[model samples]
Target: MSALLSLRSVSVNFGRGEKALRVVDGVSFDIDVGGTLGLVGESGSGKSVTSLAVLRLIPERLGWSTRGRIEFEGQNLLDLPADKMPEIRGRDIAMIFQEPMSSLNPVMTIGSQISEALFLHGWPNRAKRHARVVEMLRLVGIPDPEGRLGAYPHQFSGGMRQRVMIAMALACSPKLLIADEATTALDVTIQAQVLELMKKIRSDTGTAILMISHDLGVIADICDRVVVMYSGRVVEVADIRSLLQRPAHPYTRGLLESVPRKGQERERLYQVPGSVPMAGSVRQGCPFRARCSVAVDKCAVKMPPMFRFAEDQRAACWVSAEQSNAPVIEDLK
Candidate 1:
């Protein structure tokens, strides 16, 4: 199957002089048409930055560039002309950001905000834009689209605001949707509802999705494939079942172990030791070696190459070639 979106060894950096920093380093992945690929990592792992680079949404002063190509719909996005980017943004790709309150205009009516996407993208008629606004709201499951259209952002609840954001993002029926921590602010129930809605939208429209989140459970539930990120790079990539059942990277294992399970009794939750190295402080080795229990002299001395587990699964770890022999915590204790 051909990829609808592909990132080949992409790198994104920021700052200048002594402050120069590389936030995303040599990361690559591909998402197939109508497939969902989850980018999972702890905070500050460059997942969001990677997504922003794909959308050309990174801050201008930050000085972001990709040494590699971001191919979407058979075109290299990095080489797309500035004038053409806007057409690609709303028509070919869309994003649902983490914060609705900040992303949504404070004074604009919910319906009008969605309509702006249509207008900017050359909808060309007030009647068609109005119809699209209402259709999109209904598509995202907002209640009473006609009445909601007149209501401002402040009038809607957090979940409703997010729905409006989703409605706006889908207003153009983009082929790929990039969701950056889209559920973080919502309560669990609402998060589940939004995710279900996204699944429904995907089924109905055949839209490919790239979902970025720090929550492993969210990814497990919604994504077909998963990519584990660590310190600005991809550490593991696998289908959902294999990833959750038999993660290969030590960082991936740590993430799985860190999540609390039902009826489990332990003194404290397992935590990945040490902080993510500051953007420029990363060394020439496995980025997680500072926290990996399985780290050896080789792990600390050089970055591991990606080892294939199967056709659809791969991980960046020397141990990925063999079953991990590292001692478990129970054995250590």
Candidate 2:
């Protein structure tokens, strides 16, 4: 399958000159058409920032800037005129932000909020837009869709609000859906329901999904391919099965081990030693070296290029690159 969205050497920085901080550095990946890709990492790993950059939503007034190519359907989004972005943002690519409460307008009725997207994207007939809004609410499992149309955001529970957000995002049938930490605020049962809803939506609409989360379990539940990130850089990329069974980068391994297993309820869960370093703090070398157990001298001197371990697996680690039986691909630097 061809790529639906491709990010090449995409870097996002905050501030200017000597004090600039690189929050997302040299990240490259692809989401194939109708496929699900997960961007997994801990907080401060730049997962959210990367997704925001895709939509050109970063606040430029605050000294934010993004570099590198973001291509959708063979068009470089970075090169597109600023005024042209709004047209593509809602109709072609829609995002489900992390917090539904903050993302939604508390004062607006649910129906009006959803219909706004349809209206902005050319659903001119008021009757048709209302019908579509009702259909979307029903599609997302909301009951009494028509009756609830006048309900304010404060009237709905957290899960229902999130479902409304999804309804609004999918109202126009976007080709790509960027869900950033969509399930984080929900309880376990609600989280599972949301994931299942997303899966059903993808299957029914054939929309490619970019699932971003700090939970590997969530990623494992939905993603076909996983991109593991540490600090501001991507450390590993692989098929879900390969990454879970044999993680190449130490950071990836640590993330997997930290997840509590089904039968290990009595045992204390393993934790990755130390916290993620602040972005841009490590000017040279691997950002994970301080936390990695297997770091060598080379790890401290410079960052390792991505090494190929299989047809679909790659990792950026000196040990993995040097020790792998498969030929290393050092051109990713």
Candidate No. with top lDDT: 2
Per-residue lDDT, model 2, residue 108, is 92
In model 1, the worst 10-residue window by lDDT is 324-333
Quote the positional error of residue 322 for candidate 2 in Å. 1.9
The estimated TM-scores of all candidates read 0.94, 0.98
Tens-digit lDDT track of model 2 for 194-277: 999999999999999999999999999999999998899999999999999999999999999999888776557789999999
C-alpha lDDT (0 to 100) for residue 134 of candidate 1: 94
Q: lDDT of all the models against the reference?
A: 0.86, 0.93
Error of 2 at 227 (Å): 0.7
Stretches of model 2 off by over 4 angstroms after superposition:
330-333
lDDT of 1 at 329: 18
The parts of candidate 1 lying over 4 Å away from their true place are: 16-19, 322-333
lDDT, candidate 2, equals 0.93
